[model samples]
Target: MKLQKGWKLLSSAALAVVLALTGCSQTAAPTQPGTEATTGQTPQDDGGQADMTAMLRLNLKTEPPSLDPPKGFDTTSNEVLNATMEGLARLDKDHKPQPAMAEKWTVSEDGKTYTFTLRDSKWSNGDPVTAQDFEFAFKRILDPNNAFPSAFLAYYIAGAEEYNTGKGNADAVLVKAFDDKTLEVKLNAPAGFFTHILTQPTFFPVNKKVVESNSKWAENASSIVTNGPFKMEDWVHDQSIKIVKNDGYWDKDSVKLAGINWFMVNDENTQYQMYKTGQLDKVSSVPNDMKKQLIDSGEAKVDSDASIYYYRMNTKMPPFNNVNIRKAFALAIDRQSLIDNVVQGKQTRALAHVPYGFPEPAGGDFREKGGDYLKDNDIEQAKELLKKGMEEEGWTTLPLVTMTYNTSDGHKAIAQVLQEMYKKNLGIEIKLESKEWKVFLSDQRARNLQFSRSTIPADYGDPINYLELYVTDHPGNRINYSNKEYDALVEKIRNTADETERFKLMHDAEKIFMDDMPLVPIYFATKIFMDQPNVNGIVRHPVGTTDYKWAEVRKK
Candidate 1:
């Protein structure tokens, strides 16, 4: 799912936890079946006490490599981490920023600084959460030795660049704990979406004491302490992980479910069978063949997932460095046909690098505004470009390039289709490689493949997340694509607060990238999940992990 954009507030729950300085009194009513039951419940008058504790079974393909939010790439781990840890702010159902660990914040008139006031909260270990934790986490991520993928999240923070470069002390970085409860942030420039960035799990606080106590702080489940609604009850690598509600949480009343049991099962058919037998509470990434059966039986729910599928070319490689080669490859593909035949109309054909409904200019669509840059398929043009590219590289024929994809049936099918299309339409020889998800990620990060399929889920409901990957010197620029002009436009967009001017600059930058075809636009994927009728209150976010904080299930 994509990240949420705007501010969204919360609603009160039926049960409340009485919190005092020393401890809390556990007194809540028992929950019903087919519902998100409570953990700590009071005895009822009928006959026997009801079981307040409920377990949610989730189907996952793989276990997260690390629970450390800064070091992992698995979305499953992100989902669990989001529940167990909180940031200064969080996105609500409306995709707007809402209070989480920080009760409120203020942006300076110049928009270069933000100050946040923390709420009186405690970690699962009962240690008080302070602003120092945030400072420590931010500095740790910025450390070059750590080499966290999420280090970019703090790049915009004031003085982060200097700190990251080892040119300045950690204390000089933009983040500072004004006192035990208050925190202040400084930015290099006016960042309009800075608060939205705070909602991401990367910005969550990490206890200094906890990290020091266990050098492998996030390596084992026992080493970490939760500051959000849930805590890791049990975690077995590559097997299963269980999360139980943190009864000591500051906002414990809103968390209804007692716990969630996440199972790691890669086989799609096995997961489907488990769902049918009521062993799985929720299942996503459904295959195309079963869509009809599930829909006909009224068991499947479809939503437009905020995931944009695309293929990135390793610009550091030989032919890919040629713009004509990249453009020819982009134009040769029949996106609509792939969407209809390969994905079975489950996805939307992507017109621009950034998909539609991503908040671009109002007067015209991105493609229309793009002019010649949005050129559609032309077999003759693709053939001409390929001929020129091969001749420029002093070759009679194109090299046998490899395209790597994740080891899913759907991904394999798409890869085969792409291979055939390029060979037939553009006379380009291509090879297909499929690997496990984890292996594929590692290989991609290491730039081991010539061309790789990737998807970007919006971090804060902005187009910049997709565009920034190609910026000069960006660590996530795994393909090593760089353009000075493109970087200038990106910087301009970031500095400009005027929506109209910013969009114009953004569109211009997108046009430049499309012209070069650093990444081929594929399609926006649609999320298909299976949920029983009793399931309710689960809101799917467009950008980040789906929010289940306020969700409640009720039996008919």
Candidate 2:
């Protein structure tokens, strides 16, 4: 209660709670699950320049660690990669695949072969982009040594997983360049969402020559070679990255803004102030106190994200090793209270792992069909479960549990609220711990914490991505959760071509996941942001991503 009062006082004063904030503590910049190292110092000018007025000005939640496609897994790097690199396909406003680098293609009747023909395109450095570039980039990502996080998404390609795991020869890895313009791929099985998979940044091509000639090619702003709507023109570490329109882009004529200036402002208050002072034209998020006011005035926008915030229990660790104990914790959390009092953003209470908006092949949303799996703040049931779990374990007293999370003001507030909830409802005390982003991920992957705050963003539009997370062998299954039935259903969903059957398998897998109570579902997130009035054509997807390729800035 005291902490909540203090936070309310801070908000009432238009101030954020003072919290420790630091970039990834690596000597270099931090790296997220699917991203590269983000370490670089501000660079002096390298001759490339563009007019400021012609550039779109926006603020970044944090500076991205690396822009290399294979390692660009996080949202920050995705923003730059989406703008500066062209994949074989890109997502349209409706989140459907649209042609980009590849003009057209065909698949074999067996649904195992794909042939892609490259369009006439050149890199920003005037080098030709060929079918070999795509072939090389794909092979590089599948290389066992690289171990890119999203490499599994490409496992549908014949020999991809084998090559990635070093179980098969690289030469047998099915992707081949038939000519300067034609590329062929053989898949192990047909993936209904394969085209959408190509739209991911990890599938974007890299110039083999540029990467080989200079290993640090992507680190420097000016030397970075790209084949997209814009090219990196300048980068000042911890300050901003500047990109300008690429004259050599295949569809350069459609490019609206000549450039974009992306400022790295991790502090929410600083970002809001910059927007207010006209130093920034847009911010990815706004202060909670200002969110409603801005929305009421039509200066802010809110959109749902295909994401779920949850807490993964360390099943391999004590106390949580019992399923009933896990259920007790899951049932005790007051998701509505957390959202209404703490988050104060447009967010929906999450009863299941998957968010509410993801599409189902036959028709409606996944969450709508599955319905709620757990009730809210069932204190009596929670206490009963805790008592039963203790009795089962033959313990007279419960052990102390520690909850860990990455550092952020908002996260701290959320953690505090949860701490109080558990203490109040279950009489179980939770010790809180904080670490830098990279370290936090490292610990989570190693299962070094008792309970950890975590989230899974949908890699594609499929519920399988969420279901696959807890599969016995999945690397993303950080909690070491495993159930034979759950694993079998996940595999069944992949091979079951029938949409109805696949949906059933997916639901069954989720049911097993929830029954085990390996994780506590908190809330489905929403993006609430503020943008300058004149900014037009910006595409904000409920996926929590922004596509600026077609964005236009016009004088009002």
- lDDT winner: 2
Worst 10 residues of 1 by lDDT: 14-23
Each prediction's whole-model lDDT (CA) = 0.71, 0.76
The sequence of per-residue lDDT tens digits that candidate 2 reaches over residues 1-556 is 1124224513423122212111111111111111111111111223433222567888765667578887767677889988999888877766677788999988888777889999999988889999999999899888878767667777778888788877986788899999989999888776777887888888999998998788788887877899988999998976789999888999887787888999877677888898899888677677754555565566675665678888999898879999999999998876765665567665777777877666677777788788778886677898999999999999888888999988766777778778767876788878999886656766876668889998677777778878887877566788888899888888778777778888888888888889999998888776666666556556665543478876666554
> What is the TM-score of each predicted model, taking all chains together?
0.87, 0.87
Which regions in candidate 1 have their CA more than 4 angstroms from the true location? 1-51, 292-298, 360-372
With candidate 1 superimposed using the best TM-score fit, by how many Å does residue 118's alpha carbon deviate from the native? 0.9
Per-residue alpha-carbon lDDT of candidate 1 for residues 1-556, written as tens digits (9 for 90 to 100): 1112211111011001100011111111111111221221111224332223666678667867667878774576688788788999887766677888998888899988899999999988889999999888888888877778777778788778677767776877878897988889988877777888888888888988988778787876777787988887888888888888888878888887777788988877788889888888677766655654564465675565556788889888877878788878887776655554445434666656775435544664443354334444556788888888888889775767889998776677677777767766776778888888888888887777789998777777667777777787676787888889999888777667777787777778988888778877787666567764445456566667776675544433
